[model samples]
Target chain A: MVKSIHIEKLNYVYQSGTPFSRRALTDVSLDIKTGSYTAIIGHTGSGKSTLLQHLNGLLKPTSGSLTVAGNHITSETKNKELNELRHHVGFVFQFPEAQLFEETVLKDIAFAPKNFGKSDEEAEQVAAKMATLVGLPDSVLDSSPFELSGGQMRRVAIAGVLAMEPQILVLDEPTAGLDPKGRLEMMEMFEQLHQEQHLTIILVTHQMNDVANYADHVVVMENGGLIANSTPERVFSDPDWLHKHHLGLPQTTAFAAKLAKQGVPFETLPLTEKQLAEKLAELMPQSGGELHG
Target chain B: MVVPFVYAFNILNLYFFMFRIMVLLILKTKFERERTMDGIIDIKDLCFRYSQENEKLDLSHVDLHVNEGEWLAVIGHNGSGKSTLAKAIDGLIEPESGEIFVDGQKLTEESLWNIRKKIGMVFQNPDNQFVGADVEGDVAFGLENQGIEREEMHIRVKEALQVVNMQDFAKHEPVRLSGGQKQRVAIAGVLALRPKIVIFDESTSMLDPEGRMQIISLIKQMNREEGFTVISITHDIDEASLADRVVVVDDGKIMGDSLPEELFQKGNELIDLGLDVPYPQRLKFELNKRGIQTPSEYMDEGSMVNWLSRSILKN
Candidate 1:
């Protein structure tokens, strides 16, 4: 697999060399293996969003280098090539649906590709394909983007990004306020997009359960720096550090903590309740001592 | 025995006179005192639509009386008008045809300022709501706007930051905070206003799961410890499950208003409204179909385990 991103010593100072200057990311470095499902998890103000922005050249790093999917993200890069790079690495922002303002949902999704001078005939077909990818019906083609429900609008907006046929898909808080089912579907879509499309998927989220079940790699950021980078099982295994940063463990971890007090030592800390339940069932007593309760 | 009867008769007559007076007084005071509580955000046949001649607001025969110190969760899908209702209450939008009474003063043009002071709103996008360059400055914005005294403003800013546990970030720039931290500062800004009621308009929607948890936990603390009434607008059914009462709005009207368990019982109706049940609620419902017993209060994680353990033990 090709290495999609190779960022080296990237530094971003908010005010830059002034009295008010604050270093958002200091000497940060990471690389993305093409088609990997990576989650960037962090507390508020961890520069997680800032780092993601750098990935797509949305925000230029103050010093050092960033090469995403293939283009170098620096002012020295030619504008034409940089624009093409943007076409390859899609950035779906939080509340992306709010960016939709076109008359119809179909046109809204087609806007990005059409901006690149794709023929209207070609744009419409791409839009329909993208719409299906995000679970939107063909009927939504004529409905006003603003008139659709929030979840539908969110999906429509995502379809808009997918319509561009980006090789690298980056989403910020894609399922922040979604219901359980919606969250599950959104995460599954991430896996599907990565697996089926061979897309390098970078998801920025605070959901531990998602990080637990889906992400191939998890990166945690705190205090304007990347602190922990590991697999979901390893990251969630030591949730104390997460808690110290004012981050919360998944409910299953907390439940395991409770059982620890009851003399039932959890063999492992499970981030999802299903895992916790199954683990418990496997550890259930065949014949126990006196019931203490 | 004859002497006792004479004293008892006099006392009995005196008690009867007071009882009649008390009955009339209580009846007279019922609605009047209830109106005086700074509670009861009353709306009358409230209506608002983006534009007229295009089938204006479909709301009405509508009535809701939120008591002081109560936490009410409003749940709905996009375009369900939950936000529109919040906007009306916050005076962001005027009801096209109808009236609102906040603490007894109708939301007339002249009374809106006062009503707004009583209700502090936190929007979904914490970034846009931020007006300060730094954390301390941001929290102080609401206080400064209210023209609070300089020294008092400093004290209030500190207190509000402490309330959301963002005191350490006081000197940090608002732009530098994490998605969750920025939200806490935004909430602190509202807290400095000392509003009687705080409306969280899905404020955590822009945050990650971690950020979302911190924000809500702080909000709960504020509501419980600070004695402020809270109205939360949420799409997360799990978050809605934590609320005392859940009001489900659908297609611009109230579809269900009850405790979370009761509302979730209307399974298909809720699904049709574009909402999903919380995890345990869904699990319990599914378990019931399979002859497994699960109670509603077990809807929470810890309690669910305790219930399951005991039930399994009994068998």
Candidate 2:
């Protein structure tokens, strides 16, 4: 029951004291368990990104407090004092490929580690290991990152973050802009990391299917406030609330709901395609092609 | 006798020249007919390569025709050359071989600027498209580039903003707008140009779910109401499902071209092309595996719901 991250009454206002001042997050509170996969879902400007920025001390809370990976942060926290916290919290920004700038893929991946005081040789070694972990071939390690394809560039950016060997990995729409196959592969890589490497994952995504399939816990945000914090099943059980917030249900959950309205018996909603298939199979006849459309 | 033979050879040469001219005239008419076959954009065996070292052409002998007022969705995995085809159509990059015709005008160096005016492209990143200080300024940037008068630019910019429902944010800076609003502003920029065709190059890929829906609806409105032909290049199957025709590109070639409903039915082929099968189709596949027979034809969410309810009620 170790809490990897805990936020209490966190508030953030952008451009405070100016005419353009706006409150991004208002007294939000949440807890993320260590080694647990958590998905954050909300509309744009819902303070999801603002809250994520606070996890690694990218943005300090205007009021209240947060403790992430044993590092305490508040408005009083200085930029220079956040080095230790950042080491344990890795952030993969949206369109991360745009962030790659090194001449070679290996150099780009090794940049973060070398910046954190690792020797050149040590950083390169770690970078190579992380690159392979992210499915990047060694042949391209010496090549310019700009020469790689979009999907490969994304992997290099991810390997750069993984080179830090952080305990908590935060991803902001990591699969955005990728093809369906690439999206699936990227999601699977993160899942493998979460299960095998035991890394705590916090993902901000618009994809409900990713939430239902991968996340154990879900957090919902609306208008700069925390609305719901619970398991995926509890959060998605009521479709009305999600729709009201301009959110959507996972395909399987939505399909199950449609079936439920037609007098199909269900103890609980199926969250995944496999679960839906199993549930429908029990009610169906063993013979194939017997029922008329 | 030899003088008469030379005279006959000269006469034969004249006949051959006349026959060649006649054939050329016929081919010219046929080519023009194909270019104007109600296709606003026609690409014929287009081939392009990024560099000499590139082993395969970025766009390899690709032939695609987009009908007037049609919403065409081009989908492919990363580096599959779907974007290259779009760039070729826009004249952003010159192809190594083959021809492209937009609005029946061939795309060449001489016609590049004129053809560009007819096609407006919204790229993946809205931030990159911004060239002005505020929303209104951004929308008017294109018109300004064309030497439009200030008063006329103002009217058109306002109208474009009103169409995207971004009129209220006319004074808002790009930094202040949400992702969806930024995209709307980008669309307004395209709309002010009054282009015949609008290319959404993975425009919704950077947006959230609600933002994506808003942009998609706006594109649909433009295509249906305003009579603008749409060419959307995307990776989202759901978005592609909304198009009138879906073209699957794999490895610099068109793998499948059909209606979205018919295309989704080829489940394994879509997966092989690095695309996704729609949710309803995936559900059908899962059900069929467990000895429950589902229809072979593709079913969207609504039809799938109806079929599921009907079958379960029968049992």
Candidate 3:
């Protein structure tokens, strides 16, 4: 598979030369394959957000190098030279709705495309398409973005990013404050995009369930360093390691651990609800009793 | 004449003694009635609207009663008026009709500040609420507001910090703290006021999972050990599950009110209402579909484990 993003020994420091210098990322090197779903899990101040900012040239590495969507970025890279790279990486910030400030939802979604030098007609067309893709109704297109509910406003923000037509979709806790139904819808829409458009997804989330369900690859960060980069199965296999880092397992895996304590054998850890159910069904006796109240 | 006067004096003393006994009995019953009949926080026929043009009220005829020392979680989808109801309790917004009482004091212009002093609220954004440069200063801000004495404020701030386990970060700048640490400071600030009721308005929503867990555990400790009446407005099911009672609000009305265990049994209905179904319920549905029988009642993770161990593993 082609690499969508590659980082080699990336380091970032806040206020580097000054007396109040702080290191945010240290010796971080990782690669995300094109058309793959990757989840970044970490506690706050764990350098995940810093690494994400590095992807879109929002912050340049203090040392080392990175290449996102085939655009090479180094510490010495000029700001003017990174504009082209920005078009290929759609960054959906945490609480992206906070950025919405337009007369209409259509106008808000079209803003990015217009900024990227598309004509009015072209930008509006792309905005309409992206808005529909994000499940926004046609009737809401002309309404004020501020008038919409929190979930709809969020979709408008995401549609704005999608209007840019990026190959890599980077999400920062996209479901942060949404209700469960809204969270599920947002995630499913991303899954559809991943399947239909083959866009590479890089998600930073605190929800382990999302990581288990959507992400094939998991990266665990801690205290300004990348600690683990592996498949979800391998990452979640060590309960003790995860517990020690104050990380949590998916609800399914945590439940499976309880069953393990009760002498249930697991050839492999189940990472999702469906996987756990199937595993338990295979283990139970063929003749199951009726459910009791 | 002296004997007659003495007899009159004795009779007057007996009458006074009987009146005193009658007054004490009446007062005792009134106190008990107030304590037992009314909740610590009570809302009666509360109605509110942001604008008259809107067809529906933001909060319509909502009636809720939060018991003293009860942890009640209010959950709803966005625009469902859960937050509105909470704000009404805090007198942040006046309801168009109906009444709200906190600690038995009616929510009115005259009693608003006194009611506020009895309630402490922790908002979602920690950074927005940080008023002081350092942790200690921020914790003491509330105390300093009511013109608390310097010596008393010092003792209270230290005690509040200790309760939230942020005593070590007393001198740390607000910018230096992580999201969790900042929330702890926010919580410490609330604790310093020593309010009878604490409202967490999506306080843990902005935090990461670990940070969220820390705050949730702290909330539990505050509710259980400190005996604070907790009203947490949230969308997180995990947070709601830990509460003593769950109140479901929909379209500016109370939809359902029950214990966490019972509330989750209506699994698909909850999902339809934009709320999360509990993990155990989901697992139960999956298991039942696979020809495996599980209990119909909602079982928390621990109970589910024990049942599965006894039923399936034992075989």
Candidate 4:
């Protein structure tokens, strides 16, 4: 099977050689399958952000190597080669809307493509398509990005990155600070992009619901190290382990655990509300009578 | 004769002093009565517009009443005028046509100073509100503006930090602290002033899950334990569930005002308004749709779990 990202013994240090030097990632190694949706979860001071920066060659490893989309990135890799790798992996930082600078929304979205060598017409075309994909109306494309609401500006910024058409998309808390509806819309957009475009998506968030809803694979990070790499079901099935790490289970899984504690029988833990409901229905008597009456 | 004259003078002084004390006591109780009767914050026919160029009013003929020590949550989508309401209450912006009575005093330019003292605001971005070099410094900045005595400022700052459970990180710089810690310090700054009302304007939106939880618990404690009225303007449904009252704002109007459970009972309607129902509430709805009968009181996960274990599993 093809791998979207493969890291071997990767280590990263911030402010290396200074008195304040700290190891952000220690011998972290993981493999991301091509076209898979991955969510990285951790508390503050965890190395999730550091590891994400390495996916797109934004941060060079102090040791070990990372291969992203066919480009091998190591401490010794040239800057020119790293830039080439970045084009294949688009990175969206936290509060990406803060990065918007162009006068018009269309211009901002087209900036990256034009910088990557697309013609003005070609870049604008790609930008317009991306804007539509992110659920922005055509009427707002010409308006000043600053004039748009926070959620709209966020979409415009996302469109800017999507216009690059990267095979691998890495987002850091893409839905942070958005309203509930906006949050759902943003996640759904990314899910659609991943499914329809067959893109490899890596999301870094503290929200377990987002993980349970979208992520097929889960990577748990703690204390600058990779702790667990498994499916979301496996990662969240054990409540004690998650709580020990200061992590919370998705509400559905937590509810399932609560039911289990009260002597509800389940062959396997359910990771979603629908699953729990289905399991409960199966345990009910076939008479279809209301139990509470 | 001289002794008799001195006795009369003393008696007159005592009478005047007693009269003054009585008047002061009456005024104080009258003020308290007004505050308790009308609500700590009373808004009537409130209207505001960003500028003449803007076609629609940001807030229009809105009426809201926040009782003392009540936790009121304001929820809405972006551009829904929730933030404008917060700003208006804090005296940061003047409403085009409305009257805001904070602590029984009408909000006006002349009364802004006294009104500001009653309401403390914590904005969305933690970085924007941090004006000091360190946590301790930041907490003390508010007191310094009020010209509090040096020794008294130190006492209040320490007390505030203790309230937010950040007493140990007093010297930490804003840059070094986590998002949660910075927000705690910001809250500490507000607490030092001892404001009667605290407005949280999406303060937890930028934090991670743990951070958000920390701030939420702190807000709850402030309302329940300290008796400070809270007005939290947010988009988070879980946070709104903790409030005593939830007000939904849409298009600069009060769309719905009710208990969180009642509001969420209109599940799809809320979703259509760009709001979300709590997970347990949504799950109950889904189960009902699938022909399963969930207990009506299952508004949270624990209760739902209990019901499922006892009722469905027993059968």
Candidate 5:
């Protein structure tokens, strides 16, 4: 499979010169397969954010190299081609509602496309489609962005990025402060986008459940370096390693591990509650009565 | 004639003495009533709106009673008026038609100064609340506002920092601290006020898991060990699960109030309310759906696993 993002010995330094220079990422290398849903998990100050900024050419690598959509970015890479690179990689920051500054939701969604040289009619058409794609009604398109709810504002901000029609979508904690329903809906929408559009989705989050449920690949970061890059099941299978790195397993997996310790017949760790229930039901006697009403 | 005058004077003195004793007894009863109130913070028929002309109230006819030293978690979606309730309690905004009593004193414009002294609030963004350059400076900011003596301020600042486990980071600049550490400093600042009630308005929402855990543990310590009344406004199910009571807010009204275990049992109802059922509860629901009997009381991972192993998996 073609790699959507490739990093080789990537290093990023904050304020790289005088007294306050700090190395944010060091000797980090990873590859995200095309159309894969990748989740980056780590503690704060582990250089996850720094690494994310490198994906869309927002931040130049201090030493190593990054290749995104066949464009190679290095320390000496100029700003000339960054605009082209950004057009293909949409970046959504945390608290994206703060990014919505347009007068109306429609205008906000249309802003990105207009900047990319789309005509007024064309931009509005794309924005209208993006609004529906994000589950917003046509009624809210004309309303001021500030008048909308936090979730609506977030969707508008996201639609703004989606209007650019990027192939690879990068989100940083997209559902951080949303309610449970909103969080679930947002993740499901991203999953849908990934499936239908074949968009490569890279999400940075601390939500282990999301990582377990949505991520095809998991990348664990620790103190300026890539510690593990593998399937979510493999990464979560080693509880001790996760613990040593100050991380935790999804709740169902942790519970399953406890059951296994108590001598329950379990071959694989269950990642979700439904899986756990199915596994338990299989252990019951097939000829007997039901366990509950 | 002189004997009759003396008798009259003595009778007057006796009456005066009786009146004084009655007054003292009434004052004593009033003081006892103040001390014996059921709730430390009592809100009645609270209604508020941003403007009088606005037809809809931001908080509508809400009533709440927070028992002293109890950790009450307020769960709601965005624009659900949970934060509005917090602000009203903190005296940052006054209700349009209602009464609030904090520590047996009615909350009014005249009493706001005193009420504020008993209630401290920690907002969502740590950076926005940090008014000082360093940890100690931020923690002492609240004390300095009350015109406390320098010696007393230093003592309180040290005590507050110790409570949040940020004593060693007193000299660290706010910008240099992690999101968790900055929030700890914010909590320390609130603690320095020595308030009876501390309201956390989505304080852990922006933090990573480790930071969120640290803040939750700190909140638990403040509620349990220190016996501070806690009202945490949040959408985090994990945080709400640890509370003594959970209050669901929706559309500017109180939707439900119950213990965390009981509230989460209505799993689909909670999800419809834009709230999450905790993982253990969800697991129990799934197990029940799969024809495995799991008790509703198994709301935590350890207990759920224990119950499943002993009852269902024992075969």
Candidate 6:
């Protein structure tokens, strides 16, 4: 796996030295293993957003080094080339698609590549291809971006980012307000991209269920500091650790914990529905009676 | 001449008394219905559309009844008119034909302030709702507009902050607070007015699940203590599952309005409508497929597990 994102002792403070000075991030150091799907979980004001901003050079750290794609992002690089790095490290801001301003979805999708000096014909070609990749229908290309459904519009926004074809893709709260199915759909898309393209993914989400199913790495933050960084199973098993940070495991995980406390001899912690079924079946009597109300 | 004058005087006195009684009753109803009293909103056949987008209104013949001190969650896919209906109640937009009464007054600009007096709304985007750049200022903006006296304003602002556990942030800049904290400030602003109903219109939609939980739990606590009517407009059914009653809106009409279990029983339909059919519901649904006769309804995760354990043990 490639080490796509590397941060060393990163620090960021808002309004430093002023009466309102706030340390948004302090001594943050972490490496996002290249090609691994990661989920960053934290309550708001927990420096999750601040950390996200730092990943793409949108916000410079007050101190420490960041090595991304062999580029020293923390160093005062040339302005022209910073844009170049951003192209490779594509970031889709929360509800990014809602900010689309174009006469047609096709035009909106092509806007990014056009800014990068791709010819009109070449940009449209790339946009068309990216549009399909994000699951937007071909007919939507000529349709007004604003006229499409909210879900469709969101896909178009993601397609705009996909047009950039960055090695590392960072999405901030992609499923914040979506319904459960829409959220799952978005996760499926992310999983597919990571599995097929081997694109390094940095997902910032609050849903433990999502992290439980897809994330290879889980980063927990609280009050401007990293609290825990580990795999889902290890972190979720320690209910006390998660509870201390205002985090809760998936409902299923919590249920499994309850069973474990009842002196059930579970082989391992169950994080998914299937695991829960298998674990419970093993403990219960073979002649399972019909479950009643 | 004296007899004729006396008759006229008697008639005039009777008319004046009747007028005063009518005025007193109206004023009395206005104050009581707004202050800590219940059954605030009664809406029927409500269909609203923007004049600019007249052809676009999907909410037609909508019927909803919300009681005082009750929490009702309206959920659906995007563009389901949940937000639009909320705005209509707030008088942000008027329904074309439907009549909405806040404390028994028809929806009209003349009665808008009085209606708004009964309810305060918190929108989806915390940034859009802030009237001031700073935290205290943002919270105070609504109170100031309502012409609350300065001293009373100070007292209420502090009270609202104390309620949401955001008292220490009275002077902090809005940008300094996290999204959840910012929403807490937003809720405080609405709370300061002491409105009978505080409508949260997807207020936590922009937050992470952790922040979403914080916001919802805060509202739940407030509902238990303060007894305000909570009407939440959301797309997340899981969050909606915690409400008193779940109303599923599809297309432009409500397809189902019942307890969470009733809608969940319509399993595939709920899924087709783009709802996740909550965790406990999903578990029960799968169990039923496996020939398990679960109870009529399982209230929550803990209860579901408890019921399963008991049933298995009994059997």
Best candidate, lDDT-wise?
Answer: 3
Candidate 5 per-residue C-alpha lDDT over B176-266 given as tens digits, one digit per residue, 9 for 90 to 100:
8988999999999999989999999999988878888999999999999999999999887778988999998988999889998788777
Winner on lDDT (3 vs 4): 3
State the TM-score for model 1: 0.80
Assess each model's interface with DockQ, reporting 2 decimals per model.
0.27, 0.47, 0.66, 0.54, 0.51, 0.32
lDDT of 4 by residue, A127-191 (tens): 99999999999999999999999889999999999999999999999988887788888999999
Those runs of model 3 whose alpha carbons end farther than 4 Å from true positions after fitting are: A289-293, B1-34
Q: Name the better of 1 and 2 by DockQ.
A: 2
Query: A1-293 in candidate 2: lDDT tens per residue?
Result: 89999999999999988999989999998999999999999887788988998998879998999999999999999998899999999999988999999999999999999999999999999999999999988899999999998888999999999999999999999998887888988999999999989999999998999999999999999899989999999998889988888899998998899889878888999999999989888876666657656
lDDT of 6 by residue, B1-315 (tens): 799899899999999999999999999999886763435787889887656556766677888888777889887777777778888888988678888887667889899988898898888887777777777788889988988899998898899999988999898998767788888999999999888888898888887566677898888887777898898887666567778888877766877788766666665567666577667676666555555455675457678777656544543
Q: Point out the worst 10-residue segment of candidate 1 chain A by lDDT.
A: A284-293
The CAPRI classification for model 4 reads as medium
- After superposition, the stretches of candidate 2 with alpha carbons farther than 4 Å from their true spots are A15-21, B1-38
The alpha-carbon lDDT assigned to residue B9 of candidate 5 equals 96
lDDT string, candidate 2, B96-169, tens digits: 99999899899999999999999999999887888999899999999999999999999999999999999999
DockQ of 1: 0.27
DockQ of 3: 0.66
Clashing pairs in 3: none
Q: What lDDT tens digits, residue by residue, belong to model 1 across residues B1-315?
A: 799998999899889989999999998899667565556577777877767675747454455667777889998765678888898888887677877887667998888899899998998887788888889998998788889999999999999989899899999987667778889998889989989989999887777676777888887888788988899998766667667888877767777789977776665456555466545554456445544444544346566666555544454
lDDT of model 4, residue A216: 98
Q: Residues B1-315, candidate 3, lDDT per residue (tens digit)?
A: 799999999999999999999999999999998895699988999999998898889998988998998999998887788889888999999799999988878899999999998899998988899999899999999999899999999999999999999999999999989898999999999999999999999999888777898999999999999999999998778889889999989999999999988888898888765568888889989988888887666788889888877777666
| TM-score for chain A in each prediction | 0.91, 0.96, 0.98, 0.96, 0.96, 0.94
Q: Which of the two, 2 or 5, has more lDDT?
A: 2
Query: lDDT per prediction?
Result: 0.78, 0.90, 0.92, 0.89, 0.88, 0.80
* Fnat value of model 6: 0.41
Judging by DockQ against the true structure, name the best candidate: 3
Q: How high is each candidate's TM-score?
A: 0.80, 0.90, 0.94, 0.92, 0.92, 0.86
Cα-based lDDT at residue B79, candidate 6: 75
Q: Which residue runs does candidate 4 get wrong by more than 4 Å?
A: A289-293, B1-35, B296-298
| Model 2 CAPRI rating | acceptable
